[model samples]
Target: MHTEHDWISTPITADILRGALDLEHTAHGVLPHRLPAWARAQSTDGQLAMAEAQPSGVRLAFRTRATAVELDALPTKRVYVGAPPRPEGLYDLLVDGRPAGQASVSGGNTLTIDMTTGSAEHRPGPAGTLRFTELPDGAKDIEIWLPHNETTELVALRTDAPIEPVPDRGRKVWLHHGSSISHGSDAASPTTTWPALAASLGGVELINLGLAGSALLDPFTARTLRDTPADLISVKMGINVVNADLMRLRAFGPAVHGFLDTIREGHPTAPLLVVSPVLCPIHEDTPGPSAPDFSALGEGRLGFVAMGEPEETASGKLTLGVIRDELARIVKQRVAEDPNLYYLDGRDLYGEDDSAELPLPDQIHPDAATHRRMGERFAELAFTADGAFAGRGA
Candidate 1:
C-alpha cells in the first residue's frame, strides 16, 4: 500500500551485498552468484547453474534509520513436476544482528523441474514487494537475507530514510563449501540454515559455496576456494559423492587431495577443516545415484530413495562410511606436515542418536530443527576453545 513517491529508492550496489562471489546484471535486475562468472562459464549443467544463482548465503546489509523498508524482487521458485506445490521462499529481516521479522513474496516466476527427465521449464511472473515496517526508531544495522532456495533477482530497495552499507565489524570470515545440505535445503529460512546459524554463534562472516547437486570435485570449484579470501575454511565432503555415485574410492582420494592442495595454494596457513558427510542411514553403507521417491506424492510428501545396491561398494563404489574412513586417513596423513589442516567427522555434528530424534524429512536433507541441532553442535565443536577455528580473526 506504499506509494512509490513516498519511499526513497537505494541503488542495490555490491557494497551492500555479502556472501556472494559475483553479481550478474540481468535484463530484469541484479542476480547474485555464489560462483564467479568464469567458474560458471565452465559448466553447462542446468542444475549447477540454477544452484549457483540461488544465493544461499547472500544478504543485503546496511545501516539505516528507516522504520519502513521494502524490497522489490523477482524470485524464480522451483516446482517439482507432479509433486505438491512448495511454499513461497521466506526473506528474513535482521535488526542489529537479531531476527526481527520474516516475510515472503506472494508471486514470482516458476521453474517447473522434472526430476525424472532432468528437464526444467520456466514461466515468467511479476515481481513482488516484501515490506517490513515499524522497525526500531533510531539508526541501526539491518540485514535482509535473500531466500536460500529460490533464484532471486533484486529489482529495487526502498526505505523511508537513507541507508549506507554496513561497515566491516572485524569478524572472521568462514568460507565453506559442500552439497545441498550446506546449501540450506529444507531449512525454515536463510538465517536458520546450519551454516548461517553456526556463523552467527561463532561470530564469523560466512561465504557459503555450497552448491546443490553440484559439489563434484571440479577443478574450477577448487580454484574458486583457492581464490577467495578467508580466515577459516571448511569443506563438507562425501554426501554428494555418495549420492551421485560420482566417483570410486580410488578417484575420490586423489581428487580430495587435489582440492585441498588448491585451497592451500591461497590459504597456506589458514585453519582448514575437512568434514566428512554426516551420517545418512540410507547411504551410510549403500552406494547410490539417489532418485526421487514419488510413492507419497499423493500424500504431498517428496522423498528420496537410493538407486544403487549395497554390494556395489565391493567394486570400489563410494559410500558415506568408506568416505569417512578415507577422509580421516587423508587428513591424518597431511596433518603431519600441515599443522593447520584439520578434520572433523561429520557424524560428530549429526549422528545416529540425533537422527533418531530428528530424522531427515526427505531422507536426504535435514529439517529445520535438525539444522539448528547441527549448527549448535558445530559451533560447540569447531568454534570453542581448543577447536579447529579457535583464535581465528578477520
Candidate 2:
C-alpha cells in the first residue's frame, strides 16, 4: 500500500519458480512445496507438512532484464524450545549460473517446538524484504535459492525491469529421497546440500524429496517418485527406518521390495539407485528411537543419543551397519533381474575413514565441508560415464 523505489510489483505465480514441484496459494501468500498438494493431504502429520514446505532445494528461477530485484516473503522459522538459537536462514542468489549475493529476512513468523513434550506453538510475525541490487544486465537467468530449513511464503516480487520464466535447458531431472542429511541439515547453505551440489556437478535438474525425520520408505513417497518425471531416481534408505525403530529385519526386506515395486510401477527401467545410510557412529552398532541428550541443555545445546543396545540386534533390531549390509544384499539380488537397478554403498560417500577428519557435528548429519565432499563423490560414482545412472531415459 506504500511506495518505495518506484517499485513495480510482480505477482508471485507458478510460472517463475523451479525446484518446487507444486505451488500452493494461501490467504497470506504462495507457499512452495517439494511434494504436491495432493500428496501432502495424505499425511496429516504436522511434522511432514512443515518439512515439505521448508523449501529445501527450492528456488525461484527466471530471466530478467532488471538491474535490481526485491522479494517480499514471509518465512516461518522454527525454534527448538530448549536448544541453541539457529542462525537466520540464508537466501543465495545466482546470476547467469554464478554466485551473485546472499541475504536473510528478519521478523517473520516463529514456531516454537518442544520436542520432549511433542508440543508446538506458532506465533505470527511480519513479512520481511530481501533485495539484490546492481546485477549484470542484458536478460540473464537469475535463481534465488530459498532457505533450506525455513518455510518461506512468496508474498510479492518487485523488480526494476520485466521478468519471465527461464526456458528449460534440457537437463535430466534427478529425483532423490533421503533423510535429514539430504535435507541439508547442518549444511551451510541451501545450494550447498549434497544433492544440490551433485545436481550442479552432474548437470541435472534436482527435485529433492529428502524430508527430515521422514523418508521411512512410505508407499505415498514411492508413489510420488513414480509420478514425478525423473531421468534418474535414487532412494537413500535405512537411517529413518532405524532411527524411528519403525521396522525390524523381518519387515525391512518386504518393505524395501514394496517401495521399489511402487516406484518401478511407473519408472520400470529408470536408473533406480538404492543408497544405504552413511556412517553414524552412534547408530552403527546400536539401534534407535534416538533420545535427546540434555546434559548441555543449560548451555542451550541439544544432542542425540542412541537408545538401542548392541544386544538388541539379536532380536532383529536395525542399525546403520546392519541396514547398509541389508541394502547391498537386497540390491544385489534384485539387480540380477533388473539391470537398470543399481546400488551405492552410502559409506562410499562417507565412512569411518572420512569421519576421522570430518566428523558429524551432531553425531548424525554431515558438516558443510563433508556435504561438499559427498556431493563430489556422488557425481563421480553415479553420474559419470557408464555409472549406475549412466543410460538414463526416465
RMSD of each: 1.4, 1.8
Q: What TM-score would each prediction reach against the true structure?
A: 0.97, 0.96
Could you tell me the lDDT of residue 312 within candidate 1?
88
lDDT of 1 by residue, 1-394 (tens): 6764378899898999999999999988899999999999999988899999998989999999999999999999899877878878999999999999999987889999887677889999999999999898998999999999999999999999999989878899999999999999998899999999999999999999999988898899999999999999999999888778899999999999999999999999999999999989889988988888868654667888888888888999988999999999999999999999999999999999988998888889999999999899888899988889976743
Error of 2 at 138 (Å): 0.7
| Best candidate (score: lDDT) | 1
Clashes of each: 0, 0
lDDT for each residue of candidate 2 in 157-265, tens digit (9 for 90 to 100): 9888888889878778999999899999988899999999988888888889999988888788889999998888999999988779999999998899999999999
